[model samples]
Structures are given as structure tokens and as C-alpha cells.
Target chain A: MSQKQEPRRKPGRPKAGTDQPDARDAILDQAEFCFAAAGFAGASLRDIATRAGVNQALLRYYFGSKQDLFDAVFRRRGGMISGRRHVLLDRALAEAEPTVETLVRAYLRPQWEMKQSGPGGAAFIALQARVHAEPEAHALDLRREVYDPSLKRYIDALSGLLPAIPRDLVATRMAFLVGAYLFMLNDLGRLADLSEGQIREIPPDDMLEQLVRFLSAGLLAPAI
Target chain B: MSQKQEPRRKPGRPKAGTDQPDARDAILDQAEFCFAAAGFAGASLRDIATRAGVNQALLRYYFGSKQDLFDAVFRRRGGMISGRRHVLLDRALAEAEPTVETLVRAYLRPQWEMKQSGPGGAAFIALQARVHAEPEAHALDLRREVYDPSLKRYIDALSGLLPAIPRDLVATRMAFLVGAYLFMLNDLGRLADLSEGQIREIPPDDMLEQLVRFLSAGLLAPAI
Candidate 1:
């Protein structure tokens, strides 16, 4: 790692600044962990600072406040769905006439891959789970404040491919499917004996098959 | 209603034994509500007792500790599903055979309408959501203490119905379905706006139809 650049510290006798890990990263890391474990309202700035091993007061100086810190964390390193999906879009579009299984896999695999191998990745995944529990906490706000538009783009893209299902039904089902993705990503590997890499091998194809079976049969209008 | 043969706590002085609302039920009700809102580790017995209008000391007298209280709420609504129908055996048994719609509604509605519509129903529903969030909190202990053997009977019943799907696949699909049910319930109306009497108009058949149409097609096992 390149030598860390010193973040500007407020003027002080001790040249006051983070005495431990880089204050900004440390705060973000701690906030993510706490949000993942205890949820947003269930945790506080004091709790994050203590875990980050810094003066609680410095947390405010570094991140402005807890909500701002949360926003920064939400915006951290490719966390939001804001940029550069041309490759994913091209692939999904290429399969515009894809089977249900193929389509489901296309939608879910990106989120699953994002969950791999990072410090904040797992914690952010957990924070996402926490947001699901207390949705009023941040799910919509983060969506709006960040990249909901990109998400809509993806959803609209999927809908184009799934013309048979009613749009509203598709929207609701998509919401639930996304919930499943976030839930499984947050805890499935840890809760089960499987490793992250291990669960990855389940073949998105097989999962896609199951999702197709579910949606086609699940929401078909009452013409049993 | 027959008056107690023995004079109960007089109205003015009020008997300590079992008054208007006995301490135990009050505690359970309040604890379930608190646990639903605050989660297992997050809620305090004092808050539960306060909400119940019982003294906090009585909480200790009844349940010992907060974890004990947590366990109590999950176990409180025991016998929600007593056992599976042994005769439900002879049906055409394939995950495909039940038709996606039948399976989807069957998998979901139990969690939806499977409980008593009493004061604790909403709170009980919330309890399930918490369990989904932190399955570890209830897993080993609840498995030992609360998992009804009848659940296997029901899964077996499903297995018998969905013979084409592998056993493990059925189980995983069921797991995701359970996750979907709880997440949607947390977000969607606890009960659909239709009144209980009006709900009869939307029979199990129609509900199942909606589920199968949507989920079956969306989540089908990908065709090779």
C-alpha cells in the first residue's frame, strides 16, 4: 500500500488527529460493521468511534456526523450502482430473448460477485440486511441518494426481457428477489458451513432455473 | 361465566394471584411486542414490563433474563402447525406436478395465515421476521426446543408433491421462499386490506394462482 497521506486535522497542541488507523477508513469500517450487526438506529457514533479506536470527538471532525458518515460509507468504493454498467448492460441486452433461468442469473450474479473478497464488502452486505429489517432506516434513502436511477435502468432492462408478466407484478417480484439476494449474500455463507467461494459454484444457471419456475407459476393470474 | 367457586382477588384490593390480566401473559405479550420492535438483544425486560404495566421485578420472577424472555416469545405460540396430513400423501408428487402456482401458495400462505388472529398475531408475525434476520439467535436452541417434527412432515408432503425437483433443491427453494415470505410480510400489509369476511372472497385457490403465476415462472430451474 502506498504511504498514507495525512488527512488535515483540526489545529491542536497534540497536532490532534487520528492516533490509530486512518481515521476516515477506520470510521467507515467501524460504522459498516456496527450497522451490519446492530443496525443503524441500534448503533451510534460513539459505538463506531470506540470500535475504530479513536477519540469519540474526532469522529465528528472526520465524518461530520453519523448520518453523513453513513452516506460516505454508502458511497464508498463501488458500493452504489452508479457507474459503468455498459458491459453488464450489453450482456443482459444481448440475451434479451433469454430464458427465465438465464434472465434471473443475469440479474443476480452481479450483486453476488460484488459480495466477494473485500474488507467492507461483507459488512456492507450486512448493513444492507440491517436496512431491510429497519427499511425506514436507509434502504429507500440510500437508493434515492445514490443510484436508484441505475437500479431502475436495470429493472427496466429486465422487464423488457420479461414481457409476459404484468409490469407491477414483475416490480413486486423483483423487489422480493432482490430481498432474497441481499439476505443470502449477508449471511448464507457464514450461517451455513459454506465459504463465499464455495457457494459461488452453485451455478447461477441452476438458480436461474428455480427463479423462473417460481415466477412463471407464482404470479400467473388466477387461471389455474 | 361461572364466578370462581373460591373468592378471587377482590375487585378493590385485587388478588395478587391472577388478576385482570395475569402477570405471565402480560409479560409474554409485552415481550413479544418489544422483541418484535427492538429485536432479541436490543430490547430490555424493563421496557417489556413497563409496556405490560407490570413491575420489572416480576419479569425476572417470570422469565429469569432477557435471553430467556427471547426464547419464551418464540416458543409462546407453540403448536401453530400441529402436524402434517398423513393422507396428503397420494397426490401427484413432483415440484412440477403441483404446478408452480400451487406449490408457491402452499409454501407461502401457511406463514401468512397460519397463526391465530388474536392480539399477538401481528407481534408473532414480527417475531418470525426477527428469527429470519438473526437465525443464530434461535437456531440450535429453537431447533432443540421448538421445531415441530410436523415441519418435516410438511416438507415431506411437499417432497412427495414435487418429485421431479431434487430434495436439496426443494429445500433451498423453500428456504428462499421462507425468506421471501418474511421479508414481504415485514414490508407489505400484515394482512391484506380485505377484511376477514371479505378475504373469503379471495380463496386459497386464487391466492395460490397469483403466487404461482409470478414466482413459478420467475424462479424455475433453468432449462438446459
Candidate 2:
């Protein structure tokens, strides 16, 4: 599948230059849209190529296969989000005493900010929600590849803030926090409809503060 | 679209009898599996009919159309869950002071119970998660038909319990609670994987208690 010796390679196309990386980025962009809209099983490579305005040959050459392309799209944004979380966590750690609120904010704020990162960010958030409902195999794959390590780091931070809480309970609370965050992010509009437009009126920053308080309390709740 | 005068109706079937309702139930069972496995757009009427062991004509005779069938599947369970919530809330209200814990447990425990009811219960929960990731039009349709009224009733009860919390914040916290519950239910296995087998050890009843405690704390968190 390597394109190194393939005769199909176009000559004189600005060899190893700016446009080559742009092409890869464009393919990832369209793939993110397709995968987000249709999911891993439903998205078609042909349709993705057509949407990206690239030929199928070049698409495969760049990303190798459909699953590989999906991983690439997932990693592209997943890596960015993970990087942001680390920076936020570092800032929280520098505080005199990083309370549960600071750690919770560190975990939640980067994702909230993702909503403002433009259409790609929004698409990725939607895609992550869809990924949750994916079949067990794909869900496990993403969990291992993208989510597990980053989640562990955050959970460790949460546990560090609440040493008296049992480690397992700390993990459970963190899991609950993530579930709430992802679910709310995807269902913000539905919440609006259910709450008579009241939820929609709360600005994102205010919502984040509300979430931090709610989650911090949950994490610090007395053991049952 | 009316089937009132269709020759497709099979005679000799006991009219207004036990066998008639069984056929509708069978179709719904199959449709739930298909929709949960493949989503609304991915699942087809023909496949559902085949899996149900009924003719396509009979399927249409019972359910009218694809969208109508989806709505029926949604309403079948949505109605039952709503009914259970009403019962739980009524009982909780009978107490001298229904703690936030009681109200939150009333809202959450029934859905957890559904997971053990049968295959239908599990499928409906999965379908509900998938529905959150569906197109806005379909998600909105479900919110209007099944979710909005029931959620409002529960939120009102929670607000009544926590009178000091602003009404809008009450709704927001309830929204967060539902998000967390749905996300956790769908990702139980993922949680196990992320927590390195720690989460898998918690029994369902224990998990429910943990969820109730976490959510009750969230609901009662002081308004930011």
C-alpha cells in the first residue's frame, strides 16, 4: 500500500512542500465531517474523497485505509484537547492549594473552549458523543488509543486533591463528571427545549462555573 | 396512509384478542434491536420485518411507516419510564421532607431497573443514547414527544425540594444529572476499561447508590 514506488504519483507537484501537508489536512477535515455525520460504519471513503476534492488514489496514499483515516482524525483533535488539559492542570497545580474546584475547572474548561474553536472543534465534540454509542469494539479501541491515558492523568489529579476519599470512589466521581460533561455538551439544545429556553440563556462561562461547582461537590460528597 | 380498508389484513386472526397485540410487540422488539445497532438512518423496515419473522406487509399494516414505527418504539418505553417516575415521585412527595437524595433516586433508579427488565429495556436505553447523537430534527421530535414533559415534572420536584436554589439553576443541575446518568449507563464497560477494572467491581445497586449520592450533591450544590 506504500506509494513510494507507485507510478500513479503525480510529478512536479511541488515535491514535499506546503501543499502536500495541506492536502493531508484537507482529507482529515472532510473525514472528520463524514465520520461525525455518519459514524465509522456509515461513512464512505469514496464520498469523503469526493467531498475533499481529491482523488481516491491520493486519499488512500495519504491515510492508508479508512480505519487509519478515522484514527488520524480522532488523534488530530484528541491530541490538541489532551495538550490543553495538561497546560490547565499545570496552572492548577501551581496554585497554593489546588482545590477540587480548580482541578474540575482544569478538566472541564478546555472542552468548553473547544466549542469556540470553530466548526472542526464542534464536529469533533459531536463525533465523540457519537463514538460513545458506537459498538463495543470501536468504543474500546478509542478508549485504549485516545482516552485512557489522558483520563488517568486527570483522575490522578482529582484524587490528589481529595486524599481522604477512597481511590476507587474518586475514580467513580471522575467518571461521573466526564459522563455529565459529554452528555451535556451534546444535549445542550435538548436541555433548552426541555427547560423553556432557560438553559440556553446561561452563557458558556457561567455554565462552566455551574458545572465545576456541581462536579466539585459530587467529588467531595461523603462516602455512601 | 390509513390501513382501515386494506386487503393486506389477515383474516381469522382473533380480533381484539391476545394474538393481535403480540404481533405489534414482536415488531417493536425487532425494531429496537435494529435501531439501536444501526441507528435510525441505518436501520431499514425490511430488515426489521425479517428479524421479527413477519411479512413486510404485516409490518406496515401494524406500524404505518418507518418514522411512525420509530416513534412507536420510543413512546412504548418512554411512556412506561415516565409512568414509573410519576409513581416514584408521588411516593417521595408523601414523605414529610423529601430529601434531594430521594428525588434524585426517584428520577434515576427506575432507568437502572429497566436495564434488567429484558432485552427490550436494554435496547431502549441504548437507543436513547444514540438518539442524543441523532440529527437535530429527530432529537427535537423525541424531546417534544417523550422527554420534555416528564423531565419538567421531575425538575419541578427537585426545585421544590431545594427551594433556595434558583429555579433556572435547578433546571441546569437536573440537566447535568440526566446527562451523567445516560452517559454512565451507556459507557459502563468503557468506564471499567478506563479505571483498570476498578469500576467493574461495583455492583449495580452500589453503583446506583453512588450515582444518587453524586447527583444529589450536584443538585444541592450552592448556586454559583
Candidate 3:
């Protein structure tokens, strides 16, 4: 219940300065793995502590319970996530008349260049996938806190291209894009085999252009 | 473990007809709901049986165990699912050339028009959403058995139109479309309040035309 935010905390070690992923980092790592596997209720502090090579006493010393550890994990990473979504859209939209390709690339590039391709990409993707399916309050808090600011820019850019479509329909189409983005980011392993690695080589610009065209057409299609 | 498929029984109901949803049907419904809410191990047969207004014995009688019941639910719905996807796509593609709009409609129409629409569509959606997130043997079985056939058709059609881009890229775009379809069908219950009723009101032909034009432009767009 009593959780503290360590937002301004230094990136490296604590006061004593220990090495490794860090006790805090290690705990989050195992929690991500556990939550991804056993889910929220099914995972235990002992399991996490065991996985992290730490004692249960140290876990409680830092974060009161399993959920406190979870809260810390969400709060710390949530900004990076929203930031990824925000930067992509904002950078693309900054153009005088950002083409659909620029816009699509803007949306996807941040994820790929950062989390999706980096060391922790798979775990982050798994966490995102887990949140979508389960929707913990911690994750929802971050989603509500950050989604609009990050995504509204994309909606505006898309609206600019399709003036004929009603504002609400534009919003609906945006919603469609968001859903698809979640699938692409989360289904890495399945998609790895599914698409045969074209996602890897194709330039983000071209991929994005095709995405916008496909989505714009599909969303505008009549509901049969 | 002796889970028989009711091999000797006649189709529909017995001549001495039963009024209930049937033991097997009840178990499936309850299992789907419970699985949707809590997932596999998180859900219990006693809970499912209680939810179905039947005894636990009935569930065991029809499906042997929880795993058996889970497999049976997916197994029963498997054909209807894959068949609907193929039929929808086939109808949409039968024309000399197909537009993205028609393709989108055909892709989505089957899930919308099922006879079982009155029940918990959201629950089923949520369940599938959860299963797809983690993906074990159960999720894989359904994906291959229920999804791959139609997915191939969609990919083949898209590949024909955009031959320059890699075939895998086309499939990823298709995956994006599927993501949107799944989200709309499952969530997005607030569409009416959002003034998104236009999605439901437009004629199917007009809708398809708009979608195809929008998709075609972007898919073929060399602007990137």
C-alpha cells in the first residue's frame, strides 16, 4: 500500500554501489518473467526472490509485497513506453506534410530501434502482451495517464489525410491501428515464424507507408 | 480419461429431447467463461460446473478433466472458425479483382454474424486475447487449426497486388488487419457513445470501396 517513487534515482548502483543487474533490477526482471508465466495471482514473492538470488526478507525490505514490487516495475518502465509512442508520432508529425509512410515509420521506429531490438525487448514485449490480456490497475494507470498524449498526435495527423471521414470514424480507425500495434509488438515469437523475417530487413519507412494505406482502406470499409 | 465423442448419439437432440443447453454444451460455455476470466489453472471445474448450474459430475462425464474440457471447447468450435474465415475470404475474392474493402469485410463478417452472438462475445474475445498473449499448446492448436488456413488466403491475395515488397511484409500487414478485427469484435463497446455508429450504418459496398481505395493507395504508395 505504501509505495514510493524512485523516479529521480541514479541509473547505476545504490548508496553502497553493488554490481549485477542490481537487486532492484533483478527483482523486476524475475517479476516480469514470473508475471508473464504465472500471472499476478499465481506468482509468489518466494519464487521471485529465488529467481533473483535474493532473500525474501530483502524483497520485503525494499518493496512491501509482491504487488509493491509490481507497482515499482510498472511506474519505472511506463514512462519509457509512453515516451517511445510519443516520440515516434511527434517526430513524424513535425514534417510540413508528413506522408503516411513517415507517420507509420514514426509510430513503429521508436519501438524497434529501442525496446523491440535491444537486450530486454522480448521481456518488454511479453510484459506488454500480459498487460493487454490481464490489465492490472498499475498498468491501466500508466495507460490512462499516458496514452492520449502519446497517441492524440497520430490521430490528428491521420485526420489531416482523410478530411472526408468523420472525426469519430477517424478515432475508430486510430483505435484499429492501436490494436494492430499491440499485436505486432507483442506477438514477436509467433510473428517471427509467421512473416518469415521480412519485418527485420524492410526499412521502417516503407513498412509504415504500407501500414497506413492498408489501415486507412480497411477502416473506411463499410461494416457488412 | 475415457472421454468419448458421443459417437452413438444422433445429431441435434435425442428423440427424447433435452431442453437444457446439454451437459456438454453447458460445460463448454462455463469453461469458456471461466477461462476467459481466470485462464487455465486459475479456473476450476467446480467453479465452471457451478456457473453452468450443473454438477461437477456432468463436466467430468462429458469431458473427462479440465484439460479435456478445455481441449474439447476449442475442438468443437475449430471447424466453424476456420471454415468461416475461408468462406468469407473466398466470397470476397471470387470477383475478377478484389479491393481491400471487400477483403476486410469478408475477413471480419463471419465473426460478427455467428448464431451464438447473444452469448458472451466479449468474454470469448477476452479469453482469446489472453490465450494469444502467452500462447501455449492450447493457443497454438487453435491458431494452426483455426487461423492458418484463412490467413494463407489473405496473404496470397495481398501478395498478388504488391509483388515488389517482400511476401512476409504483406503477411505482417495482414497480421495488422487481424489485430484490428480482433479488437473491434472483442472490445470497443463504447462505439455508439463515441458517435462511431457510422461504422455500422454504411452500405457494405460503399464501405468496401472506401477501404480498398484507402488501402490500395498506401500499399502502392512509393512516397516513402
Q: Local error of candidate 2 at A122, Å?
A: 0.6
Model 3 chain B: ten consecutive residues of lowest lDDT:
B190-199
A132 in model 2: Cα distance from truth in Å? 1.4
lDDT of 3 by residue, B80-110 (tens): 6668878877777788887755676676665
Residue B59 in model 1: lDDT: 86
Ten residues in a row with the worst lDDT in model 3 chain A? A215-224
Q: State in Å the error of residue B211, model 3.
A: 7.4
Of the candidates shown, which would achieve the greatest TM-score relative to the real structure? 2
Candidate number of the best DockQ: 2
Name the top lDDT candidate: 2
Model 3, A129-205: lDDT tens per residue? 56656533455555555455666667677668767766666666666666676676665446544554344555544
> Candidate 2, residues B41-123: lDDT per residue as tens digits?
77888899888867877778988988889888988898888889888988999989888898888888788988778888998
List TM-score per model, in order: 0.72, 0.87, 0.75
List runs of model 3 lying over 4 Å from the truth: A1-21, A57-61, A64-68, A87-97, A117-119, A135-142, A160-162, A192-224, B1-21, B57-61, B93-98, B135-138, B157-166, B190-224
Ranking of candidates on TM-score, top first = 2, 3, 1
lDDT of 1: 0.57
Please give, for residues A1-224, the per-residue lDDT of candidate 2 as tens digits.
77677465454465565554687788899999888877776788899988886787777898897888988898888878888888888888888888889888888877888866888888898888887776558665874677667678888887777778777778777888987898777766566755665546777668878888998899999886
